[model samples]
Target: MDTVIAYLPSILRGTWITIAVALCSILLAVLLGLLGAWGKLAVSKVANIFADAYTTLIRGVPDLVLMLLLFYGGQQLLNDLGDYTGLWGYIEINHFTAGVFTIGFIYGAYMTETFRGAYLAIPSGQIEAGVACGMSPGLVFGRIIWPQLVRYALPSFGNNWLVLLKTTALVSVLGLHELVWESFTAGRSTRQLFSFFFVTLLIYLVLTAISDVGLRWLDRKYSVGVRRA
Candidate 1:
């Protein structure tokens, strides 16, 4: 409709923020996931217990609650630290940082499980073979375990990513200027509720579609040498 067209720029800007949030969050998630997976598999009982507690606590809590807690808790903690150092008054956390870290911290637990399963799926023989060839642990991981784990993890990773993309909508609750926030603002301003929401829905659909295609391409690329004839 004409109203939707008029709001295109606003919608696009919000979409950009949403994408940025998702990208940053996913990057954090992947890094944390890797570390968490390593911790879970570490030799030390302390490391294992810490990792287990993190995964269990994150998985058990509702994501929205976690997001709220992290945002408020982070703000308060920073403010307290600033006060201690006589830096200034309250140090506020912006919505973008809040949203990204919230999603990343929440999903990283799931990603940890995915990565762990993928690693376990790899046969012990491959690692042994690498060791027999006098490869260092790092080289063995790089040359053998890494590639296979990626291939196996792609499907689950893709699923998690798609879910993560959708979860970006929740960032609106924190007043982030993402798509849902923009749509709400536009709808309220214009009183064209259906039109703005419809546009928002379309944007989400497009994002999801693009992600699906990208994941598929990655899957193919990663599986190149191993695909059966």
Candidate 2:
């Protein structure tokens, strides 16, 4: 509809915010995932227990519940602490920050399992051989571990990313003005709900299709020389 076209810019802007939030959230998730995997794999029993607990706790909760709890509860907690100590003024958590960290925190558990499985797939003998060849732990990780870890983990990682991308829509509930919110408002004003929402659906499909293509390319690049069964 013409009305949908007229509101295109606002929808696109919301799409961009959705993309930004997904990117930042994925980055944070990856960082936390790496730390969590390391903790799970570490020699220290306490580290292992802590990592296990984290993954368990996150898995037990719904993403929406966790997001709302963090956004509202975290904001309140921060202000309350600030009030009690008088160390700072009142604090507020913006929608973007809240969305990014909440999603990141939720997905990091899944990534932990992904990375852990990938790491487990690597033969320990290869690492022992690398050590035998006078390679340091860091060098062994960089040379022998990183590449295969990526190759093994990437498919699951890609799946997680797609899921995370769709999950960005959930942030609309927090008044983030993301794609869903923009489309909803546009449709309400124009009384052409299907038109605006259909456009939103197309944009999401395009994004997912593009991501799938790029991930496939990376898969091919990493799978080089491997004999496919």
Candidate 3:
């Protein structure tokens, strides 16, 4: 208990980093998800092919492999470009950026599928009705399609988010000072491996609990006026 109290500040700081990484990754995931969904649904063969290749390639790769490949590969690529431009000594790829982008890019593939399925679940008639009522395509999507997509997508979106949060732990391998990395350091320094790891477990549980509550609220908010008999 005393040791845990002593480490509270460290843990909190690390937890903040974890949260920031998750938020940034989620933002990227959402943007990529929308674009990927649009690409998958587009009539152009090139767009469809690109979307299919992205989802398939990303989904097939292991997360850790992808993370390492992205981080190291990106660094090397940047360094090579820097060398060509005579700025090799000045170029650096920060670990936080590497972690956030890697996780976001990997999970965005899954999110694309979730969004596409949700969009498909929406009835075409509703969109048509909106069109008949003199709603522009953009307005119809804004007022009708997007709302239902949110409601229908919430469950899968929440699932993907939970997984993404957990995956942030993997970024510790890249030496990011997130909770898991802190826990590892504390355990090694104090020789109280179980105690430190147990603390980390509790922290993760708390994060997941908060995420669940927030996602549920979002789900209900989006489901407004939806009736069940």
Candidate 4:
């Protein structure tokens, strides 16, 4: 108990790092998803092909394999491109950057599908009605499409967020010093692996519990005119 108490600060710091990484990854995923959804829905064949390829390739690969490949292989590719183009010198990729980009890029595919489906679920007639009302395209989207898109997307978004939070543990493999890495180090040093891991497990449960509550609140907020069965 004393040892656990003593390591509390370290664990908290690691937890903070974990949260930071996860938030950044989610933001990136949302941005990519919006863009991918737009690309897929666009009239351009090139855009559709590109969006399809991106989603297919990302979804097909295992996350860990993609992470490792992106971290190591991407670094090599960047350096090679730099050397070839004479645009810059050899560049180093930090684990934090690598981790965030990898997780975000990987999950962006899932988000893309979520967003695309949500957008499609909106009735085209509503959009047409908005246009008939003399609403600009942007205004039409904001008033009609965006709200429903968010409502439809929230469930899948919440699920993706939960999974993304758990996936942050993988960053430890890159030596990012997040919760899992910190817990593993403390346990190894104290020779109390079970104790440390038990604490880690509890913290994760708390995080997910809090997330569930927050997500529910959002669901209620967005579901204001919606009637449930």
Candidate 5:
């Protein structure tokens, strides 16, 4: 108990880093997912092909391999380009930035499918009715499409978020001082591996439990006008 208390501050700091990484990554994933969904649904063949390739490629690759490649390979690629162009000096990629972007890029593929399905689930008649009623595209989307689309998307989105939150542990391999890394360090230092790991596990379970509650609240909020079949 004393050892656990002593290590608590470091673990809490690491947990904050983990939370920050997850939040930033989720936001980026959402943005990319929205764009990918739009591209897939667009009339242009080029757009559709690009979106398909992105989702297919990312989804097929192992996440750890993708993260390593994106972090190291991307850094090398950038340095090579800089050397060739002589436009800038060698650039160092921060671990946090690399981790967030890699996670976001990988999960964006899943989110793309989620958003696409949600959008497709929306009835065309609703859209047509909105247009006929002289509502602007933005107005229609905000008042009609967005709410229902979110209602349909919320479950998958919440699942992805929970998974992504756990995935932040992978960032520890890249030398990001997140929860797993901190816990491992504390356990090694104190020679109390079981204690520290158990504590870490409890923290994760608590975080996920809170997230589940919040997601349920959001689901109810979004489903206000939705008729359950």
Candidate 6:
């Protein structure tokens, strides 16, 4: 107990880092998801082909392998580019940046499917009606499609977020010193592995609980005025 309390500050810092990584990754995932969904839905065959390949490739790869590749391979790519171009020198990718981007890129594929499904769930007639009523394409989507997309996507989005939160633990492999790494270090020093890991478990539960509440509120807000059969 004394040792655990002594390590509290370190654990807290790691917790904050974990949160930061997860938040940044999710934001990136959402953005990429939107763009990927658009690409899949685009009229251009090239856009559709590229988006399909992206989602398939990302979804098929293991997360840890992807992280390692991006971290090591990306740095190599940068060095190769710089060496060939003679425009700059070595640029090492930081752990935080690599962690955020790898997770985001991996989950972006899942988010693509989530958003795509949500978009399809909306009634096509409503969109046609909105267009017929002289709404611009942007306005029609903004007014009609976006709300229902949220309502439909919220469940899966929340699920993906919870998974993403857990996935942040994988970033510790990059030496980011996030929650799991911190706890492991403390546990190793104090021989209190169970205690530190237990604390880590509770912290995760708290995060997921908070996420559930927020998702519930969003679901209710977006379902407003819609009839549930």
TM-score of each: 0.95, 0.97, 0.95, 0.98, 0.97, 0.97
lDDT score, candidate 5, position 222: 85
Kindly report the root-mean-square deviation of model 4 from the true structure over all alpha carbons. Answer: 0.8
The TM-score measured for candidate 4 stands at 0.98
Cα shift from native, residue 225, model 6 (Å): 1.7
Residue 91 local lDDT, model 5: 100
How far residue 168's Cα lies from its native spot in candidate 5, in Å, is 0.5
Where does the lowest 10-residue lDDT sum fall in candidate 4? 1-10
Best by TM-score: 4
Q: Give the poorly placed runs of model 6, Cα more than 4 Å off.
A: none
lDDT (Cα, tens digit) per residue for candidate 3, span 1-229 = 6786788888888899999999999999988998999999999999999999999999999999999999998889888888889865756778899999999999889999999999999999999999999999899989999989999989999999999999999999999999999888988888887898899999999999999999989988998999978
User: Of the candidates numbered 3 and 6, which has the greater lDDT value?
Assistant: 6
- Tell me the tens digit of each residue's lDDT in model 6 across 1-229: 7888999999999999999999999999999999999999899999999999989999998999999999999999999999999998989889999999999999999999999999989889999999999999999988999888888999999999999999999999989989999999999989999999999999999999999999999888988998889
Q: Write the per-residue lDDT of candidate 4 for residues 12-116, one digit (tens) a residue.
A: 999999999999999999999999999899999999999999999999998989999999999999999999999999899988889999999988999999999
What Cα-based lDDT does every candidate model obtain? 0.92, 0.95, 0.92, 0.94, 0.94, 0.94
> How does model 6 score by TM-score?
0.97
**Which structure is stronger by TM-score: 1 or 4?**
4
Candidate 1's displacement at residue 197, Å, is: 0.9
lDDT of 2 by residue, 73-188 (tens): 99999999999999999888899999999999999999999999999999999999999999999999999999999999999999999999999999999999999999999999
Better of 3 and 6 by TM-score: 6
Minimum summed lDDT over a 10-residue window in model 1 is located at 220-229
Query: What tens-digit string does per-residue lDDT give for candidate 1 at 35-117?
Result: 89999988999989988999999999988899989999888988988899988887778899889989999999999999999
Deviating ranges (above 4 Å) for candidate 3: 85-90
What would the C-alpha RMSD of candidate 3 be, to one decimal place?
A: 1.5
